[model samples]
Target: MLTIIYEDEQYVAINKPNGLLVHRTRIAEEKKEFALQLLRDQLGYRVYPVHRLDRGTSGVLLFAKNSAAATPMVQAFEERQVTKTYYAIVRGYTAESETIDNPIRPDKDHQHKEAQDAVTHYTRLATIELPIAVGRYSTARYSLVKIVPETGRMHQIRKHFAHIRHYIIGDKRHGDWRHNKMFLEELDSKALLLHAYEMQFTHPFTGELTHIAAELPENMRRLCLSFDWVNAVTKHEKLTDSPV
Candidate 1:
């Protein structure tokens, strides 16, 4: 069953699991279980997706009960009025904090669409070193990062991290194949190491402020437990002094 994080007369939120599609798409034809369908069935009513989460990403997902509410919720995201906080495990030691301002093509085909400006701010929460050789290094180094995107673009987080050479763990499409293989072989991990943990926005209907959060999945928690940063980060309630 999908975990409902938030719900009201206008909207409902679910903690989506990795590899689950938000809706039907041409690229993933084999997916018979979608969040939309599962939600509709579980609630015995209709649900409209206000935003999308990557198939490999797991965490808080928002949905509107009707189209009337979906419009404003989607607009809130497009207008950059909403704040989204994501947590990721990535290869290499990322800086303490930095903003990635890069333009990304809207689609693979240049003729179809022009590039859009995309900006993402990320802060390194902690670092870990494993006694595993990868490439030229004798020990593998990784960082736990907290990311905030200033603009919404397709695959922005995955692509922006890739652009900076700190590919997120398990992100095969925009990540290093060697690092991905190592994670799978060593940790038995299969899903991308990205999670949408927190979101803050103004209620489109009630005009009140709303903040929702989801805890890291067990796999991610276990991975971060080695560094002992997850407890501190979670207990602190926020990443203070972050550049993002």
Candidate 2:
């Protein structure tokens, strides 16, 4: 059963597991199972997705039970009123905090020179060094960061981190293959180490402030423990103060 994180008459949210598609798409037609279908079957009623999480990224996924709720939540996401926090394990130690403001082209129009503005704020929760060496360095290093995306462009987090030279571990696309190989060979990890940890927004029906969060999946938690970035990384959140 999918782990339900938050539920009310207006909407329900779940801690979506990795490798699960929010819904079937033309590109991944072979996928027979989907979050929308599965949740509807499990709940015995239709669910409307107000927002989506990438198939490879595991964490909170919200759905509106009725049309009235879906409209406002969709607008909230579009206008960037909702605050989002993500935890990522990236190569190299990052600064205590940083903001990435870069323009990115949509995948279909990547060849075009023009791009949409994308911004993300991130804070380093902890850093660790491993004795294993992969490249020119004698050691390997990684950082656990909590990120707040100011704009939700496609692949913004993955591409932004890649542009800054600190690629997220196990991200096959928009990441270093060398780091991906190292994580797979040494850690037995191939899943992307990016989690959509938390979201905050004003409730659509009740107008009350709402916040929801999901624990990092087991693999991600295990990786964090390997680096001893425990409680801090799990509790690290800096998303709300700086919205849009």
Candidate 3:
């Protein structure tokens, strides 16, 4: 069942699991289940998706109860008025803080489309060096990062991180195969490590500020526990500090 993290008269949010498509699309036509269908069935009502999350990314996803309610919410996202926070476990130890400003294609298949400007700010929260070896490195190094995107673009976080060569662990599309293989074979982790984490926006109808957070998914939490970064994860989950 989908976990409902926030709900009100006109809006609802779910902690979307990794690999769940936001809705039906031709690219994934063979997939029988989708978050939209499942959420609608669970609620027994129509819901409109205001934005989308990548099929491989898991975390806070918002929807409006009615079309009228969806309009403003959608506009908020388009206008970049909403704040989104994401957490990722990346392959190498990143800088204490960094910002990535680059252009990326809208999607992998749309090479003809013009690349859009994308900016991502991240702060390294914790680092770990596993004794296990992957590739030529004697020890595997990784970092937990808090990411905030200044613009919403397709695969922005994944692509931005890849642009800087700190590929997010478990990102099959743009990650290092050696690290991904290590994560799957050695750690038994298959889900993408990038998580939406939290979102804050103004209530479209009520004119109030709304902040919603989703707890880390089991796979991510387990990995954090193994890395001994659970305390850092817990501290950030509270949304205490402003987005970097």
- Say which candidate scores most in lDDT: 3
lDDT to native, each model: 0.88, 0.89, 0.91
- Report the C-alpha lDDT of model 3 over 116-233, residue by residue, as the tens digit: 8888999999999999899888999999999999999988999899999999999999888899999999999988999999999989888999999998887887788777786677
Which stretch of 10 consecutive residues in model 1 shows the poorest summed lDDT? 235-244
RMSD of 3: 3.9
Better of 2 and 3 by TM-score: 3
Q: Give the Cα-based TM-score of candidate 2 against the true structure.
A: 0.93
- Which candidate comes out best when scored by TM-score? 3
lDDT tens readout by residue for model 1, 1-244: 9999899999999989888999999877888999999999999999999888999999889999999999999999989999999999999999999999999876564558878999999998888898988888899999989999999898999999999999999998999988898888987777799999999999998999999898776677766665566444675333332321
TM-scores for the candidates: 0.93, 0.93, 0.95
| Clash number by candidate, in order | 0, 0, 0
